[model samples]
Target: MSEVIWWKRGVIYQIYPRSYQDSNGDGIGDLNGIASRLDYLAGLGVDAIWISPFYPSPMADFGYDISDYCDVDPIFGTLQDFDRLVERAHGLGLKVILDFVPNHSSDQHPWFRESRSSRSNPKRDWYIWRDPAPDGGLPNNWVSNFGGSAWEFDASTGQYYYHAFLKEQPDLNWRNPEVREAMHEALRFWMRYGVDGFRVDVMWHLMKDEAFRDDPPNPGYREGWPDVQRVLQVNSADRPEVHEVVRGLRRVLDEFPDRVLIGEIYLPIERLVTYYGEDLSGAHLPFNFQLINAQWNAPTLASLIAEYEAALPPGGWPNWVLGNHDQKRIAARVGEEQARVAGMLLLTLRGTPTMYYGDELGIGAVTIPPDAVQDPWEKNEPGLGFNRDPQRTPMQWCPGEQAGFSSTKPWLPLSDHFREANVETLSKDPRSILSLYRALIAFRVQRPALRLGDLRLLPCGERVLAYERRLGDDRITVALNLSSEGQVVELSSRESHRVILSTYLDRQTEVATATVTLRPNEGIIIAA
Candidate 1:
């Protein structure tokens, strides 16, 4: 692999536009708001920014339900605003990747409206629609990710349409050759507009079972929660044909120089590798989400790290994600005490690193009042207590009105800890988690070993985690304290390891041997 395409080793900051910033007084974030924050992103040392869907939508799935693939929603801004955002981001040495939701479109989309008008319409086959059984029941028992049946009855067509998520988001029929061509055309439109690449939304759900057989029951089911037991199989996704779709998309992207494709696949490490394609031609990165779901302990985390490094196919790149719009923030999950260590682990890992907005500021989840909840998932399951609105609140730029997110009231509440976690406060504090994240990202950019390196785990006890990243002659060793109490890490190699970076409370100058002391949750990167 030529090192020319530096994005391969780059860090991508994901900005959920609705929660990032709001330059307009509409409460919703706009492209201009993103343009205003370019300097902050560039200063964080990220190579690119992956902005989540801002396409024309009915807000059914909060931009995931695209009503128009080619245009920006009025809520976000005009087409000109998007172009300016692309230009400004490029000027700041940051590549821009757009979220491409190719699998489905909002039911209100013009194409879907036309398709459902009549069976003989030219766009009739654009979406998957099948007739129900003689009993008037669904074709199968496939459950939607958001709960309930995956099929929705269309009164106009007298047939059921497939929807893996919300009923309003109808699945596109990849079986239709014309539909595939149209999706490719959408890709071409963006590529011509100077967009670097695409972060495909629900990439594995592009296809469904041809026979539409009922899924088998899950073994993890319990008697108390009938809804939990009903989630037997995600039959609508992970079809065998999904790979061919990815390969075809990759070929289209190959037409443009330095263009890349990334897939959002939440499968295990073994299956996730296949999305990269058989000959290193499919997705440039298939979003390794181990860190997002793994247990945050020394033994479990170490084992997961080793498994991921081993599972990646030869020559295929690996990507790490700590949090996204769907899940809770890491600071809230692992506790604020371990936030710095988590950031170090994320930035130092091989391959690309993607940081969710507000993650660098050590921002935890906020409390969204019941009346303020906008997530359809929580709205549907009343008192279920599973709400994502807390993590999706607007970013805190300052401690002032609206947390400096906007002049008007925000769509959601700000974290009570905003005063302590806001960027304004942490940017000046050297020992803050925000500072540690910046230092780690800067160190990663300057070191090639950490960018494209082979990972090797060193002998360390339960409380101390140690590893070495090596690329050719450059090698960097890292040791982290995983416990609340300090631990002494006695490196097997007694050779002196020059300290390159550290978040330790004590600024120790020298250590004759490889052995070093680490304060609780303290981490150090050394060049051996």
Candidate 2:
């Protein structure tokens, strides 16, 4: 195994810092809080931690709207605090990956402030700005991901600026050479600070169509869907020029050794694969969210996996994500019972797996009260269920006050079952979802086949998804039952295999016959 293949074979744990832990008791998680918990993460067996943005910001987008590219947000802590956290993480053998929000900057950022000051400002072209239509309407029909027009009219400059998300986050112009150099310099700054890698945010939105054409109407638009969904986003995002920008970012990472670049792209498999760049020089991992978006049924997931595997560019590595801060918890999307199955699926897949902070404990989304809603999306588009607060609530560490996430009340409500579903409570139970996650991660680490093997889909019943991972003589077969009822899967080989781990966490060392019986919402890993 290559020493630098840690990213390829290791699990990446994502930390939404504000909800992870609060050391100062300010009801918000900070860098010191995360550093204090490094041992806990090391015990969980993830090889790396990908923390969400903690850059200096106005908090309009909860740290995603970066104001200062090189400084830590006061709410998160100072530069020294981040350095200590990275040092502690490295000491524990954990890689540190920071969120790189290169597509846009907080409207309050100095760059944007200067760019919007006047049409002839030196930084005027740093962001996407255009004159209004002949009738003084929006620059184009582009819609913001949050809501309404993507173009935010600037009264002072008599021009409109584009923001794919909140107006507070003005989109940067990657088309500008100076803008690209600045973002690249920001990346290099972090890289020099001992950061292992970066999870680039809205990477596909870095470049827009130069023609400024209006996006076509979405044929599948529905009334209750987000306003942004009304358009196909053809001209506004995922433009062909984005690949060159991605390659440029890759070149910056190449300046540092053993550093990975993972792009958060929401495009389809075909378009997503393109971000890998020619000869796979773009993102080391263009996050494969098919598992997050696909139907949980066995056939749907089976086909989706096959399609994604086939769509990868030559030598392009694959990665999987079941849940994230922006989406509903995996346990909430699928029932609690199936969350274990999901964990097994995520850890056993044939590539790097990114685990959301609280999913290992089978933590589901909390119900956020109207008064407690913090997500800008939910506030901007009320009653449309665009709320992410439910999923972005504080992590349930224990059953104590604030679920041990903070001494004070958490910024958002905790799940009703936090008392029963927290790590302190679940870690003691061998059959708990948390235990299953640990065992699966350990099993993956110990087995080369599970980590770097070629995958082959196995023949199985409609309700059972089965596959084999083989690297030389090390062979492991994974069978998952996706339904409420039990499932029976037949192995191609009649040789007896030892069950290494199961979602139920009760089948280790058990010998499985050629025919395997999987309990409801159960998945198993067997070694030959």
- Point to the candidate with the largest TM-score: 2
Badly placed stretches (over 4 Å) of model 2 are: 2-4
What tens-digit string does per-residue lDDT give for candidate 1 at 9-63? 8889999999888988988888999999999899888989999999999998899
Candidate 1: residue 289 lDDT (0-100): 86
Scored by Cα lDDT, where does model 1 land? 0.85
Per-model CA lDDT versus the true structure: 0.85, 0.91
TM per candidate: 0.96, 0.99
Give the winner by lDDT.
2
lDDT per residue as tens, model 2, 1-528: 656379998999999999999999999999999998899999999999999999999999999998999999899899999999988899999999999999999999998889988999999999989999999898789999999888888999999999999999999988899999998999999999999999999898888999899999999999999999999998999998899999999999999999999999998999998988988879999998998878888899989999999998778888999999899989889989999889989988889999999999888868888899899999999999889998888888898888999989888889999999898999999889888888888888788898999999987979998899999999988999999998888877788888878888777888877787889888998887
Measure candidate 2: CA RMSD.
1.0
